[model samples]
Target: MLELHLNFCNLVEIPDAIGNLHFLEILNLMGNNFSTLPSLKELSKLQLLNLKDCRQLKYLPNLPSRTDLSSKRSLPESFSSKKDPWAFERFYDYMEAGLNTFGCPELIELERCTSTALSWTLQILLQVHYQYILPSLWNIPFPSIISSIIGGSEIPSWFNNHREGMGSIITIDESPLMHKGNNCIALACCVVFGPPASRRKAPPIIHSLNHVSVPFLCAEDRITEDHLWWFYVTSGSHIWSTKYENLKLQFHIIRESDIESWSFHGKKYGYRWVYEKDLEESNLTMICSR
Candidate 1:
């Protein structure tokens, strides 16, 4: 079979023989009860593997090189990639395939998993990006979306170049690492949105505006009651002059009711704002082409 979905079947174990399906492109085993998965190295064509909400799953096999593996609520410290860190890197490499560990709570010992496990996962993501020199997503040619938004109102402590609590404008100074000459420029912007707190009869509708002089593709998502919005954007522009030598990026989150006061001066913009913690790891990485 080219595609197989056995999600939430209350399955405890899968036979090893399933791996013989060499043509499988998508294998979905989400919401199952299994603790470990059988190796399917033979499935070379496998592209998308969804193990979301597999709370009991404690292990993930080394999927194909291009495989996009996504698992949320996979709270176990199951990524034993001491031999191959690539196994863990693939999880966040595909920006289109979100790794949503938000709202996934579990207990390992006396500590809450949201803090401990999530920390480990983000660390690995940063390490992979640093070691492997993260490749570009197929949709964009330069300045890949190599960032992620964890499910929390507050930004993580490890974040770099960040401002804390309220207000929308953020400035990123030009880094020496960025190549000179703006032949092509891109921003790996990630913003995490949490449920807005409102005490009135109606809850506030949150929105983030991008008021920068850059070419960015904007995508709008339906805002539900308590969903964490994951925003990753890749932008490239040559029209920018050397006037922006410092490159101060503005990221903001505002309420829907306040959109009337905001001016849309024809700049390419998107909704939602980034929680500021200045994750030095999560920088406004600019791809300045030489």
Candidate 2:
């Protein structure tokens, strides 16, 4: 077959029998929860495979042999200079085409710096480059200036040889940030620095509507009533209150359209009567760019 479209269906996995179609050139498996795919070693003619929006997919298996080292016709000439014949540009083009053809939502472009960092992280994880960077974090001495900024206690010596330290350094097993009965809690710490003169300066000011209990959900998990929510006014400055002492807060300005009303200590803050017009105007500009 020249093309096969399987979109918006609740498929949990691909059937191994698909490999029987040796002439199959394109297969779209979008909008599914498939965590794994069947081997396609027999489909020598396969040219494209789409797995867009397969959020649960954590790992991809090795490509089949016919498409591997022994292939007579190689990847495009543009990708020949790279160590791996299958260069990233080609993969990204294929991915984008697949997503568009398979009815995936349009990609949103964020701020340049934020998008660049996110793309780098995704590329590193996908290419398995964790082996090179993870260990170096452990080589840095504990109680160092960098560690203290991100609230890390100390660096371990074992990480000097291995680079896959993502799991080791971000352990939340005994962390106070984890809530009881919520085994899904995870913690990630990173140190972000601005100019040298502003190294110790506080972060931006963020004002929350009220003290509300909010649930923090993991990206992999589904939204549920079990989630809790907590709200507080936070900024980068060091502040002490008898109620919330020595808290380090970072502020984020979400759109006012997303918020319902302001609440402080379980009482309504009456923000609607005061800041509604200005908040709405700001929301319009901020939401569109993001």
Candidate 3:
């Protein structure tokens, strides 16, 4: 096979058989339970390695030279030390070009806020992938649940319901037909920030979760003329079990800054999902079953 996607499978370990696939080009192990990977030395053609939320993952085997790796957190020192130092430089250039095409000025501000530009850029870009881009790109073959939030006084037309405050509880009841089979994959949300200037006093922040948190696939973007800080959960994450009668989604935001270490502003906005059963799919295929 040329590709293997075993994301969100609750897997504990990968079999050595994977390395036997010499022709495999892409391997996605996002949101799994594994702590280490089987050696991939035999797969010379492997190119993309996605380890988005392998929380316990502490090690990675040697990979092909052309392979590109993506993760929300750091990999082991053995792997990170081997990274091409210029990779993030090239990535920043690419992102700058894309943003410029759309008149995005945030790139300039983002660049000015970091001493370790590579880490900061990757952190932000990863949000773009999970919250906005991934859902659009994975629509055909994989139906996913992607959602987002931004700083706005009004809710967008896309959401089924909205509340006046920071957090809300949303629950979805299952159908009888789903007993035979189901495609319930993920949950996502979009959060809006109040104002950028109000956040200027805070320090550079790393994102995290609190209060019945689930895994997240996140992204953010600036909409010109909107003046709202929007964050979206675009693709695969927010896993809930099939046995539960209702799916409860809860979210919140926090802020912090380290003045002695980093001079940066941090802002967080809380958001919650309103489960809509019969979701329209011109943009995303929300298939209820596999």
lDDT of 2 by residue, 60-124 (tens): 43233332111122224344424664354333332221111111222222132122222222222
Write model 3 residue lDDT over 1-290, tens digit each, in one string: 76577878999899988889877745767667776678776765554455655556555454432222222222222322136643432222221200011112222222121111212222232333333232233332111211211112333334444434342233334322233224322233333333233322223332322122111212212222221222233223333323455444443222111111211112223333322232323222222111
Cα distance off (Å), candidate 1, residue 74: 31
The C-alpha RMSD in Å for every predicted model, in order, reads 13.8, 21.2, 17.0
Best by lDDT: 1
What would you estimate as the lDDT of candidate 2? 0.29
Off by over 4 Å in 2: 68-290
User: Which of the predicted structures, 1 or 2, would earn the higher TM-score when compared with the native?
Assistant: 1
Summed backbone clashes in each candidate are 9, 10, 21
Highest-scoring model, TM-score: 1
lDDT of 1 by residue, 52-113 (tens): 55666554553433332222212223434465554343333332222333222221221222
As a TM-score, model 3 comes out at 0.28
* Candidates 2 and 3 compared by lDDT, better number: 3
What are the models' TM-scores?
A: 0.39, 0.26, 0.28
